[model samples]
Target: MPPADDIVYLDHLASTPLDRAVLEAMLPWLSATGAGNPHSGHRAGWRAADAVEAARAEVAALVGARPGEVVFTSGATEANNLALLGAVPEGWPVVVSAVEHPSVLEMLPELARRGHRTAVLPVDRDGRVDSADLAARLEAGPAFVSVMAANNEVGTIQPLDELAALCRACGALFHTDAVQALSTLKLDMRGQGIDLLSLSGHKLYGPQGIGALVLRDGLALRPAILGGGQQEGRRAGTLPVALCVGLGAACRLARQRRDGDAARLRLLRERLFGALSARLPGLRRNSPADGLPGCLNVTLPGLDAADLLLDLPDLALSTGSACAGGRGGPSHVLLAMGRTAEEAHGSLRFGLGRGTTEAEIDRAAERVAAAATSS
Candidate 1:
């Protein structure tokens, strides 16, 4: 790893550094004076509960959902688990895209074990879930469908509106893991026909360990974490006030800044892609043209991404999902997109974020070029 001060962090999909403003909002709750369990009824507890509810409203606003619909969880992983495992009833079918994050993909076995029939929806070469394939899957009468709003690996934005419509037509509840999409996409839970949605704080410059699942009004879910009947019995736990405050602050900022950030990041992403293409003529683009503004996945032909990244210590990049790291296998996303294992091994994912700059993009290009040529 590069020295902290010297590293060019291009792994925003893995996690983002907490925004200073978000931290400021969290600090009061993190202090000793802020100690209070939101589940309690005393004065301090009431104050904590108020803050948590306020944060819940903020998170709800980001997704255009009612405040009462938000159910806070540990993170998107937990949210995904809750949506997949809790929403679908026994003996009912559950379907998810092939390229879903591991949190969602890994639930198939458990869902199967719980007596729910699980199915995988195929994606196109650009990592998009084909609506036609989804339509066919819907014919099987899935009780619930979980598709991501945007992919974390290739950054491909799925057609959630269309997918949700198809699910609605089939009378199947739809859920989306919007953890990566919230940074650039505008989400309206009601307008999109999204029955459930999942998001994480750290993906968007908020504190880690804080996330929420937004359920459509009147939708019911079985409790995944049973405890004190918090969150109206949908989820049960002592809410983390500090993390909730940070997530709310981040969501508020995201609503205000996403459009401007998307425009700026798109140009920077193109700049980096142009720079890299000019340097390495044979590199293959993996991310689609209309994907996330700051995501650029590419295959450096004839080179292993792990080896390449090892040589460029100052440039923080990844071969695939952070969750899939150290698993000793090729990217399941690439394989799902029909790329060979060798091509998956040669792939690199560049995730620019709020802090990325043109100069850093150029320098990263130069470093990657040098490393690729030498290899």
Candidate 2:
């Protein structure tokens, strides 16, 4: 493997490196002096609780939600599980997009087993759900809908405002798995009509092992985990103070720098695509023009992406979501977007991030172009 500096990483969708500021904010909580549990009744406990609440407020501010509305969980997977399993009444109808992450897609079987009426809404070639399809589904009365704000693989941004509006018209609750959207997009939970939003710390340059579910004020869900009754019994567990602090710091930094970061990333992403297309004219862009700023997905027809990735050890890239990569299958997201199995296997996802630069993009583009032509 190449040294970290030698490798041009284009897999931010898998995970982002921890930010320096986020680490600084978490250092105190990771130290012995920061050992007090928030549930305890003492000076140390009070201080810990204060730190947690402050972090909570920071997270809330980034997404235009109240501090109390954010309920911390182990990560976005747990948050998704909680949002879907806990929010929907038993035997109630629930809907999700065909391109959702495995965390959300895997819920269908369990939901069906538990007697919930479950359905999947399809996406277009650009990986966008048709609001009319959702409107048709919502005609069944109030149902819980889980659509990601942006796709993890293609980085396609969904029409949140329109989808939320459709759901509202029929009294449906709209939930978005926003783990991949927070850093690149300005999210307004209430304004966007998002009833429940799931987020992960690692996806936004924070520490792993922490995520949150932002619930619309006054919305209630059944308890997913039962214990000492924490977070007003919405989620029950001892909060990891350091992780929470890291997530909070990340959210604060994202709020402060999101616009600038998005603009820069957009330029870098386009540069990479342009360079590759110039060299490999046969390259087909799988990512939409209006997708996430840092993401670019393309298919080099007749070449297998998995094999291409194996040859380019110095470049960090992916054939699909890291979570699903180990499962040895063509990407479900691409398949859902109407790609043939061959096209899906030929696709590669480039996820640029805060550290990506023009030089790195150029270098990566050359390397990829060379590899494709040779293959």
| Candidate 2 lDDT over residue span 71-148, tens digit each | 999899999999988888666799999999999999999999998889999999999999999999988798989999
User: Which pairs of residues collide in model 1?
Assistant: none
RMSD of 2: 0.9
Question: How high a TM-score does candidate 1 get?
Answer: 0.98
lDDT of 1: 0.92
Q: Give the range where candidate 2 is weakest over 10 consecutive residues by summed lDDT.
A: 83-92
lDDT of 1 by residue, 1-375 (tens): 657989998999899889999999999999998999998989999999999999999999999999999999999999999988787766778889999999999999988888888889888899888889888877767568999999999999999999999989989999999999998889999989999999999999999999999998887699978868888999987889999999999999999999999999899999999999999999999999899998999999889999888899899999999999989699999999999999999999999999998889999999999999999
For model 1, the superposed segments whose C-alpha errors exceed 4 Å read none
Q: What is the C-alpha lDDT of each candidate?
A: 0.92, 0.93
